[model samples]
Target: MNNNNISIQDRSKLFAVRAIKAYTELNKRHFDDAGKVLAKQFLRASTSIGANLAEGEFAQSKADFISKYSIALKEASETRYWIDIMIRSEIISENKFSSMIDEINIIIRILISTIKKLKDK
Candidate 1:
């Protein structure tokens, strides 16, 4: 999908897919069990960003939407944390981490802009 027209839900979904792909690549590289454990955490947090945003779309109230979106933003932040941990611990290569982080940052900016717009409304 075109980046300009992509919804937050779509962006977050892409993030999840990217996270899964990274995890699979790491597994193929024979990451240690500890690294695998971190990958699992990364996967959960990354996927949660989309899940929460999707759920929030049908929220019964504006307040509810804000709550869900807030949660999604938190998940995005958590995903970033996991990515940083992976890089610092040398579980994932710097190049891989940089790419992954760049994608997540896009999602983060989208979420922040969405939340700000919602709050303003």
Candidate 2:
């Protein structure tokens, strides 16, 4: 789909997919037991971002939509924190986590803008 046509849901879904891939890669790297724990936490937070966005799409009211979007934004922030931990703990490389961080930031921006528009309506 064209960039203009792609919805926030689509982008969030893509972000979740990327997160899963990263999780798999982390396992392959043979991260210590602690790394495994962090990986699971990261996976949950990352995937939740998209799940919340999708749920918001069917919200019964504008207020519900805004609430869901806000949750998704919070989840996105949590995902970023996990990425940073992974890099600092040496479970993942700086270069790898940097790209993931960039993608998460894009999702964060979209979620913020979407929430603002909904509130203004």
Candidate 3:
């Protein structure tokens, strides 16, 4: 498939966008010192999704693409981890945390399936 044919609204891209937005909003809120550490980790992991996706797009081969996407998948998982920590620590409310986690979970599944399909080809 041609890269230009891919829409920015694709699940992977959309999830990354949502993650970045959520992290930016979270960063604006004041937090205790301990909470701040989780916040920073959350921001980094969330933003890494898109950054890695961009790298995947420019991959020189199928293996390179899969490698970059695998990194994105890992980042999504990491984002989920930090989100869980934030919710359990009361840094973010259950409702907000759950929504973000749901999105990340969906993205993870999509990435996994895509990787599998590519590997099979």
Candidate 4:
């Protein structure tokens, strides 16, 4: 696989870029202290997904790739959780929450499928 192609690797790099931008915007919006904490956590978890995916691509074996991608999937789920909490707490709008959650869900599914396929090899 060509790592130079940002569109490859399950669109992980794209998702990470968008998530970082959104997190930056959210950080700059000056929410309450509690909201700020949740936002920071969410950003960290969301960005980790792409980082883990990149690592997985360079993994030495199928098992290693699966392990790394599994972590990415877990991080994506954590991001979704934080987004849901933030939205429910009124720290962020419903639209923003839904969009982020959808992206996270997509990533999670992609990672899960990739792991399963690798295991079957």
lDDT of 2 at 99: 72
- Per-residue lDDT of candidate 2, residues 23-104 (tens digit): 8877787767898999999999999999998898899998988999999999999999988888898788888677778778
Residue 104 in model 1: shift from native, Å?
0.7
Q: Where in model 3 is the C-alpha error above 4 Å? A: 1-10
TM-scores for all predictions: 0.91, 0.90, 0.83, 0.85
Off by over 4 Å in 2: 1-5
How does each model score on lDDT? 0.86, 0.87, 0.79, 0.79
Tens digits of lDDT, candidate 4, 7-63: 435577677777779888888887888988998898888888888888987999888
Give residue 2's error in model 4 in angstroms.
Answer: 21
Clash pairs for candidate 1: none
The 10-residue segment of model 2 with minimum total lDDT is 1-10
For residue 104, give model 2's deviation from the true position in Å.
0.6
Native-structure RMSD, model 4: 3.9
Weakest ten-residue segment in model 3 by summed lDDT: 1-10
Over 1-121, each residue of candidate 1 has an lDDT whose tens digit, in order, gives 3367877787788778878888788778776788888989999999999999889979999999999999999999999999899889988777857877887888888889989998998
